[model samples]
Target chain A: MSEPVVATDMRKLAATQLFALIGFTVREARNKWTLLALFTLTTLFLFALATLVSIDVVEGSIASARLFGTIPLEIGNTTIPVSDAVTVIQVAIVSLLTTFGLVLALFVTGNIVPLTLQTGWVDLLASQPLGRTVLIIGRALGAVAVVAVTFAYLFGGSWSVLTWKTGFGNAGFLVAGMIILFTFLCCYSGMVLVGVLTRNSPISIIAGVGTWFMGLILYPLHTYAEWTTAFDPGWKRSLASGIAETLYWVLPKSLELTENATRATKGDALAWTPFLASMPFAIVCIALACWWFSRQDY
Target chain B: MNVIETRDLAKTFGGALGSKVEALRGVDLQVGAGEAFGLLGPNGAGKTTLVKILLGLVGASDGDATLLGHRAGTPISRLEVGYMPERRHYPGFLTAGQVLDLFGKLLGMDATLRRQRIDLVLEEVEMSSWRNQKVGGFSKGMQQRLALAQALLPDPRVLFLDEPTEGIDPLGRVSIRGILRRNLEQGKTLFVNSHMLGEVELLCDRVAILVKGKIRREGPLSSLRAPNPEYRLTIAGSDEDAARAALAAAGQEAESVPAPPGLTVWRLEVGDRSELNNVLDATRSAGLEIEEVQRVRASLEEVFVQTINEADDDKAGAGGPGGVQTSAKGATEVSVATREVDNV
Candidate 1:
């Protein structure tokens, strides 16, 4: 009887610690709802608004399919030159896409109060019976869930409108949305990695946002400098330059999503090679982020 | 078996330019089951550091400890332990009920059990009315109560409270003491660290006076508090002079100590409590009503002062030990351990 009582007590203790560990994230989400909800809603609203405007343009200019980049392309037996109409729609879509990218960068990199609050919460939680590694992973997953929901609402609302307007229901819209969502996850989760490592909200925000700005501004500088400094380059340097040229694939340029959406909308045969190629770097960054967060002291 | 034990526990901090500051020096403690142990000390005495080590939050420089037969810092040990830290901060966003539940869950309670316990704890803390109120808005006193509630969530077998009543009101302090008493009634061990000697005096079964990271003296309050049987007298007029002359004539040792301007004091040290009344009778019959005569028992405050003074004297003299050695039950074991370590 005594042994059974002790076993029950230990079991109860373990359950309590686990719940407290996970509850840390739930409390954080509720506290910063204003910032999280606003960012999420704003991203969706802009995407939805852009989708509405794009559909209207498509309906208006569906007849002038030649003026837009809706050139004819043959893939096996099917021929679709859905350009002019698609291009008209893609322009507004791409613009919206750019804004989504900016919003993603800002939301992921801005305001670290939530992260600092999270770290303090983790400190309290780590003293319990719960594993430190489990707590860190739980926070990482919680942050990812928040980012996923935000991206879903933004991209889903836009896709719904786009599908409704085109009157051409293609299964590809779902695929394209999934691709964009994955890219956003990669970028935002990387920022969360910064947040997790520093455990300081302000520093996390600065680091995350600073990285975004660097990716945006520095990528162009590197490109221009590559052209100007081509004289000092050898084959290995040229290979390095070539690899760097594909920074959009290796980095979260947001341009890749825009380009993919444009190509998908134009009915151009989309190849999976380039998309798959850019994946290694994204995986590497995500892996590094997880590694750092996992070992981080709660 | 000892509920808690530490062997050769020492913690040294690296100061500026690598100067070594020894915070704790070979502290060996053994607290028995169901004991209310008070760790008394002044500021910078490493009392908190010792508690931190016992809690497994801070590592010792060279020593080891066990809590409930498990290594300190292990889950099994923490399972039976609850701590109310001296410097505490709780997440401000949680409601009083939520705060309780959060800690309850951390102790590994399920939803049904956690809710039930939360309700009970909220009521226990008299915060049931403010159950839905954010802790950020709770007053400092209320926060202290909430901290106590969190510490009590698991109904731990051993409770460690560091200055638990630091920011509490009188009534709040009473409530905390009541809660501790109730827990003690349930046979829980309590290790309390506080500067409030009076509070310790009332609640502690035995106390270890700590100074400069070492246990200066420890024992049951009753033992350390054995009355010194010192009697003081105040006399009027030149009777003080006559009393001194009479004391000399009567072959009784007395000191006519100058106290206030209009009063002088006659002090007589008696060996026992029964001797106090005899001394007073003799003084009165010596043609002196004895303006005021009182036999004072040594308060814990006085004991603390004397213990620290003794430590200081030992430090000053370096080797010539000549002072009262006040140690209670567990202190005997600590002395044995200290000697063992010294021999090794």
Candidate 2:
């Protein structure tokens, strides 16, 4: 009983430290007017989509139309089918979730590591009894936790609204939010590295966004160059293809992860390569950041 | 037992290309349990660096240090240690209460105890009124008060405070000093690094003066002030000749300087207290009226300046850059011409 009590105490201690960091991240995000604005915008967009989905559908002999009061959603005088309309709405929601969700989360949380490394806070924190690894990991996890809640609110609200309005809700669509969060985690790990190394918020954001864009473009470039016959098979083609592939594999697979999420929602078998590959990449980035943070003087 | 100990703790930063800055070189120090120890140095004299090493905030390049019998930089070593950095900034969004809660959580205090202690510490620092206010809106003095409150949250056995009163108003500084004095009275060892010499002189039981990363002088305040036997005598009248004659008869060297109107001050170098007594007796017998007699000792600031000047002169004479080579045993030997200070 005594041993169990001690173990319980240790667990509580760990939880306390980790949660304190999470609380700090939450408070910081709340204080940023930009983050609050983005949250409000996302909430409003979800409600707007819900309103549009609530529009009545008119079915005639040759055409079906989605009527927003008196206005009909039509393409070239051909009324859109309800299924197709729902599909279009889902696609739009997914695109928004993947694009704006990722970008806003990145922009909002980019300064977490840099702010933690600020002189007074860092020195005071480092003097605490907590392990350096715990501090770094807790901070990174805090940022991820913030992004997770934001993603869940935006994506989940949109999904719930679509399901209620159209009665065609797919629970699998929720996985896309998780995937976006994972992608953000991967990208944010790099931001953490830059922030810890430089302790500069702007530099960290630039590095994180740069890595994300590189990940998005390199994989497609590699696939295109590999399959295309535009250039003859030679050293130049091989070099370009090789560089692109190496960079794709080395950097996070942001595009591939989102694509997999889209595929998963469409009742297709999801390829786990991008998801599995991204986990290690993110882990390595966090490990490197923690290693650097632990070794450096505050 | 020593609550904090460091031997030959050295830290060197940025030696990659052409220049290296040695922040600490052979700092050997010990703070006994419940003792309030002061660390005094000029700007860039490595006082903060030493505190950082002890608190495990910075790694030492050489030698070893321990707090509470654990090696420095280990998590357990800081378990019983509290540190208030010179410049403290909390997350702006957090209320003062939240800041204390965060620190208490980091210190692994349970919720009930944390709540109770937070109130106690807040009241101690006189920040109870601002407990609900955001730290961002707080003044520097208020932030300092909050910092002190957090440092006291753990009820630590050893507290390391860097410039605890810096940027504070006079009343705030007095309040902080009183809090530190109470901590010392409660048998908590305090390692204070400050540029405020008067506070150190008033509060510390022992002090170590660092000059150019070396411990130039260290001992009890009384010992550091008067390492040699000396005394000062004030004569009632302008009887310099009689005082000199009295001191000469007593086999002592005395320097005469101007005092207030119709008075002369005589600074006598004596071998011991017996010699000082003999000088006083001789002055009385010589019919030279003695107005006042007091021990001559250097103030902490004067000692600090003299130590730094002497270190600079030594550096100039050796023609070496202002670096001293140190051994792991905390023995520092000034090596001249053989090693370039720039490369260190």
Instruction: Compute DockQ for each candidate against the true complex.
Output: 0.22, 0.45
In candidate 2, what are the lDDT values of residues A222-247, reduced to their tens digit?
A: 67654545567788677767777888
* Most accurate candidate by lDDT: 2
TM-scores for all predictions: 0.72, 0.89
The regions of model 1 sitting more than 4 angstroms off are: A1-23, A33-123, A164-199, A211-298, B15-20, B227-295, B310-344
Encode model 2's per-residue lDDT on B1-344: one tens digit a residue: 99888998888876558677878888899889989899887666788888888877888989999898989888777777788898777888889999988888787777887899899999999899999999999988988989999888888888898978877888988899999998888888989887667778778989998877788889998788766756678888876787788888988778886689889887778778787788889888988888888765656666666676688777532322224323331221111112111100
Specify the CAPRI tier of model 1. incorrect
lDDT of each: 0.63, 0.78
Question: Candidate 1, residue A285: CA error in Å?
Answer: 9.3
lDDT of 1 by residue, B27-96 (tens): 8888998999999876667787787667655667788888888877565677767777776666778788
- Candidate 1 lDDT at B196 equals 74
User: Could you tell me the TM-score of chain B in model 2?
Assistant: 0.87
How does the DockQ of candidate 1 come out?
0.22
